[model samples]
Target: MAESTTIEYLCKFCRAVVEVFGPQYLRSPNAEDTTRILAQNEAREFYGMLGSIDCLHWAWKNCPFAWQGMYKGAKGGCSVCSNVFAKLVEGHAPPVNFKVNGRQYNKGYYLADGIYPRWSTFVKTISNPVPGGKNSYFAKCQEACRKDVEQAFGVLKSLFAVVRQGPLAAVDHQVPVAWAAFLNMRQEIRDPQVHQELQKDLVEHLWRLKGNA
Candidate 1:
């Protein structure tokens, strides 16, 4: 089957799977279940968080340059990127409002970089000169937290290899939507415990690299 056809087939399969197995198969037992598991595992294992939020860019095969402006990267490129906002909750599952209309919510009072707006729910790093002219701790913390979102994108791209390469056909926005749904569904099927562990490892690894640099 063509790539597009394959995606359509998988989407149908996912809908059928969810119907047969139930939505519980794609989520935690309940919000409380999320809170407890996240709190226990993330605090003990990861040290800093339960998750992070960031954005990912995918080429829009036939999107107009005008609309593409809305999809540009923070560095000023006309690329199609999806804003993904996430966070880790200790003894708690992550937020229930994960994605809204394919755009991740920019909530929480955590750290982020300049690219994101400084909402009451988020803590963005500010560049301020110190009396002694040393690097700002606030800046460092922001960079660290921001990395979580970046790493999340990396993992998603790696797992869903299709995303790493190519322009999604403009004919079907549903294709990408289904693809994201599949990714989320796959994460659920693999178990939250395992997903939490993977996140913990990735955060630690990224932190180490940031430290070295």
Candidate 2:
């Protein structure tokens, strides 16, 4: 009965997520209209950046010991970690006509940590710094911005205790359902004016800091 109930609960929540956010949030954006203006503001030349990508571990208490080898990470716990992006778009696809440095590109990029592979679409943080200069400055800004992924996930785990505690058993579809819930909860501002104002403030602050450094 307990197993059955858990399965049913997962099914119900999963359905609720799809019904609530599918049409508007999960579907891919129209290729032509999705611009990279905000991302460009974050970094001078990094246009068309989708968001930050990273992995986080969630404790899995009910895992079988036999399976621990595969599920356990270096942290020495039975946990499930997901490689997820801070931003979500419909169809998990990026818009075409993506350009960077005056070169036309086919896909958008995600900022990630160094552990992730070096790919055209993944921007990894610099491991070593060379005193105070643009390279170090860029690394600082990149890391600060990439933290959005961790902070966003932190909010989700806070709101949904079930996620923080981990499900009794993992379901493949639960990840997307959780992402849907997170997107709704994050309450992103759609007003261009609000974003513009915030961006202006951020740019000024960062430039000021650079001058001081």
Candidate 3:
């Protein structure tokens, strides 16, 4: 149950990480996320849901040997952006394929914390949520659904027990040259309009789905 770099092999890593994913691991169905059914089953409000993102700091399981020098942080390499989830913001992750509360959303969102940028793809819980209103009810449902992410990570750590795994995380590194792409990515993540709309839609959707229950 120990995760290490010295253990260089295929079958072990495959069985641990690959087989766990199968074909659905790399190639999602029709350019959409793979966790829609599971997430929706967990909560109807998560109709077009991806998976939850948390703030649990994880060691970078695999950092490029050359970049390790610049990637040191309190938690190993801080939190590196996973390609699987990074695709969400990169404009290639998913298409506008699902409808929630009558509105269409292209990107399936992850449940993140307030530390993350306000992007449509990341949803965070309300702080000091006033109880008994939509805010309170939405907060309750969001928190409940987020528990699955915690348990999922627990299983991942148990299986590969080395570097902790973050579902979707950001990194702190300073070696960049692509100003064009960087600016664009920054623009998208900082869009308050999109974040506001997504949060509103999610609040309405979750309220309708579980508020009465």
Candidate 4:
């Protein structure tokens, strides 16, 4: 009975997401908007980038002990790992016009961490960046940009108390519902003054680190 109920609820939630919010909140950007995205990326010194890519785990507090081994890891909880990437670049598509070091390319990229595979589409910070050089600068910038994903997660968890409860402990089943909520929430808090102030402080801190390096 519980299994059937879970399935039914998941279906209804997913359907509602697609019918109501998918078109507006869950789409890749059209080509016309690419220029704006490029400008934003250039400001962060990451030309041709769409956004940061990362994952977030939503813990299943009531997960069955039998299956816990599969879902549980060092994190000490049975959790569902959500691909927390697409939402960040919603309305942004790939095959973007990118230029770096005077060379032009035609693919957008995401700043990611080391666990992700090395691909042209994902830029990982230097594990051991050489100090006082291009690698150090790039590493700093890459990490700074990558925080967009983290901030998005933080925003969702902080703003939505219900959502903070591991997506109602059915995150694996209600991904669409969670994503819909996140999309709506993102628009509401696009860029508050406090975030801008914090960003400025971070930029200054990075510059100081660069100078010291």
Candidate 5:
């Protein structure tokens, strides 16, 4: 016989669905546990820097023009997308609440392209650069931080192949936000460590590529 979807099963399914497609999805599946772990890890790796920020576009099956203004592509495409801004911090060691050591970040800042706002929390890349001066400490750090956001989006797209395909079936405009939340939850549960490692490795790899190019 086919299995029944009972309330207990439904609850679990809803939780999973929310965990996969709701706002605050990242905080759903044992968020306390994952956040603690991630905060600790980020502390060790980033010397207290939080996470990265970037924009992503998701197709809106029936989106209106007003919403489209916020969904511009990196190369000026008119696709419907959501601009996600995230912070990745180091994982603090055990028993300390795993809260980010924000003091270390007082002097440090996050890197972004021209899209993000100029907040005290984030640092934007140089809109224009002097010739032969692209290789500087500040430039390198900015490049490193910006790459984290790109890699985070990359991993998200890779795992949730549906996101890579096209517009979602849902009619609600908030569906993309829900999808982002779900992806965040999955990241929290399954491969937090993998992302941390990838972030670290990508910085070195990109630097090498820049040098070669």
Candidate 6:
């Protein structure tokens, strides 16, 4: 057999490692994980929050002509959500019970921005919040915490540049694994009613936590 080029050999090695350890390490959060996430978020006045959510854009300049449309966003650039984020969305959403203003919520949430849908899992910053009000305070805290999500994305990308740089063939080979593991992308994540309720609770919760201080 002919010897593979450096990039080809590296791709093969990376593929093998991902195949073996991806399921174990790339896996979703569990009960213990949620507990830790909750404690950390609660310290920030966001009870029952798992983390923040946001997507970044990358220019896939060499994207296939036929696939460019799919990759293109409104501004004509490619946007990709982090793989770890996919795991969280498709992963097991444990019942994270918590109370705010005497109201209870069962599922955890992520601090997002206006671009995202108003889903139960996403707690977006209040837009144009009235000055010196609970909404203003809540927006301040939520947006501040949300800033960390992008930094985390940067760190992950730096560590896993291979996954982003692998040749088309290697990426194609691994895409199926992600799809196969997608248990409930839509049903589990989209809950508008719950989102509204959760948002209300959070606004009140944060206001009480810091508004008076």
* Candidate 5: segments with Cα more than 4 A from true spot: 1-25, 28-48, 55-61, 77-110, 131-136, 161-213
Model 1, 84-106: lDDT tens digits are 22212122223543321133332
Please provide, for model 3 over 150-204, each residue's C-alpha lDDT reduced to its tens digit, 9 standing for 90 to 100: 6876787778533255432133234334667657765766677777787888789
Q: Give the higher-TM-score candidate: 2 or 3.
A: 3
Q: Name the best candidate (by lDDT).
A: 6
lDDT tens per residue, model 6, 108-153: 7778778778887788888999999989988888888877766776
Q: Model 2, 1-213: lDDT tens per residue?
A: 699999999999877776676555444343433564335533643455556644356787888989998886544777765433333322233343443333454445566666554445456666686757555666677687778666877888888764577443322222344656566423332333433333333334444556786
TM-score of 1: 0.44
- Identify the runs in model 2 with alpha carbons over 4 angstroms from their true place: 1-17, 20-45, 55-92, 161-213
lDDT digits (tens) for residues 125-166 of candidate 4: 667867976567766787877787578767877886544553
Candidate 5 accuracy as lDDT: 0.45
Give one digit per residue, the lDDT tens place, for model 5 in 1-213.
335657668668756775566544332113465455346535434332334544345545565677657765566545553322232221211122221222211222334566654444344555555544433433566666558667876787888755565423332223333556656543542343433343344344445555786
CA lDDT, every model vs. true structure: 0.45, 0.54, 0.61, 0.57, 0.45, 0.69
Off by over 4 Å in 4: 1-17, 32-35, 55-94, 160-213
Model 3 alpha-carbon drift over 4 Å, by segment: 1-43, 55-57, 60-77, 89-91, 162-186, 210-213
Q: Global lDDT for candidate 3?
A: 0.61
TM-scores of the candidates in the order shown: 0.44, 0.51, 0.62, 0.52, 0.42, 0.71
Per-residue lDDT value at 110 in model 2 = 63
RMSD of 5: 12.3
Error of 1 at 182 (Å): 30
With a 3 Å backbone cut-off (N, CA, C), the pairs that clash in candidate 2 are 26-90, 27-90, 28-90
* Lowest lDDT block of 10, candidate 5: 90-99
lDDT of 1: 0.45
Candidate 4 — what's its lDDT? 0.57
RMSD of each: 13.2, 11.6, 7.3, 12.3, 12.3, 5.6
